[model samples]
Target: MSEHPIPDAPQRRTPGDEFVQALARGLEVITSFDAEHATMTLSDVSKRTGLSRATCRRLLLTLVELGYVRTDGKAFTLTPQVLKLGTAYLAGLGLPQVAHPHLEKLSAALGESTSCAVLDGTDIVYVARCSTRRLMTVGITVGTRFPAHATSMGRVLLAAERDLALPETLPALTAHTVTDPDVLRAELVQVREQGYAVVTQELELGLRSIAVPVRTSDGKIPAAINVSLPMNSPLDPLDRLDQVQATARAIAEDLDHLH
Candidate 1:
């Protein structure tokens, strides 16, 4: 891949000596590695985290020594050990526990894959999923992430944002993917107006998905629920929206109290 500039770092606020910036920076370094950037150079890591080369190198080395990062002396990548962090959060929240049965039920009823996801920056991370059968070359899992701009769940979550912003450049994942930021903004507008999002082959050819918001009692959309199918599937997204929306609302209702 060509060199790319990383997004700006979040504003740092110094609270007190008890606030360990080093620890925070170390975690940020861990987050710099993802599916799209499974491996990165020291400079890439530095650029992504907005940390100095020396700082980034130190953190990476520390993580390496701690078995959280691995390097072949050229490019560095995170180890599976990093999954423990996300697992800890998942275990604490019990999201899968609350969402798995609902997803399974939906999948059975619709004969497709159903997933619960939450937005993570510009990506949507699957938190729970159930599939009636294999539907794609790559299977969906709890930690799977897809670009928000090209996915139904992502658009649904994005539309729920108070004021959505699109960068001038959007990655084109497929020929059908929306690359123009302006066009994508218009699509998001339509999604909000329609109270749902339907994506057709934007991420992959023959894949279609529809998503709806899972709102809390406070009306905040912390997550979304989606059902995915092949373009040639017998059922259309709208045909199953009734059950999907009801399941999402039920999950949100339970989450409001559980959380």
Candidate 2:
């Protein structure tokens, strides 16, 4: 009998490889469907991701089978079960877990609301929040999404965006919201230099807030923490801003050490 040829050694996995590439593509497809585009057709998914119709359909069907997505006749949307993926990540993040008690203490002391948020595209989604009281008419709960260009948390995160690109025309959430791109870009530059952001009544009337970037152990900013107060509250606005920024920096330092 002829001797069998020796099998080649398997290649070691690198950061960039076909397996990672395909997984990334699948994740992109899943994330592409959001609240606004919840029920998208295969053509819509393809258009949004620049993927072929067949590829989009295959991934969508796979996700549906995995219970991360659901389809009804002709439309596909993410299922509530999809949140488990993000929930697992948040649970694993030591910073959020460690910072929660501190954040609660700060909110109780200041009689204001505090939140931790990470940039998600052009929006900031609150991952953790400690609310002092139900003060605002427009309810803000954890996981709520807000425009990054109009909020202190968003600006702080945007300030860290290298060579920060600010759009010329931001969607106007309120009459006081900045719509001019140049002005917004200038503001972002100032925020980057100052290392924090303050916005007064931009998102909602009577709402004021300050935010600072949370840096990793490597000094890389991945998110922001913010304190929000009512505009009419007796708290000295300038003093509150200073304190919030200080607290955020302290928390960020703690996070750096933990990470």
**Residue range 2-69, candidate 1, lDDT tens digits:** 11224657566766979888899998898777656889999989888888999999999999999999
Question: After aligning candidate 2 to the native by TM-score, how far in Å is the CA of 221 from where it should be?
Answer: 2.1
Residue 106 lDDT (model 1) = 86
RMSD of 2: 11.8
Model 2 per-residue lDDT tens digits across residues 176-237: 88878788888998998988888887887778888888776677887788888787888865
Task: Report, for every candidate in turn, its global Cα lDDT versus the true structure.
Answer: 0.85, 0.76
Regions of model 2 farther than 4 Å from truth: 1-65, 69-80, 135-138
Clash counts per candidate, in order, are: 0, 0
Q: What residue pairs clash in candidate 2, if any at all?
A: none
User: Which predicted model would earn the best lDDT?
Assistant: 1
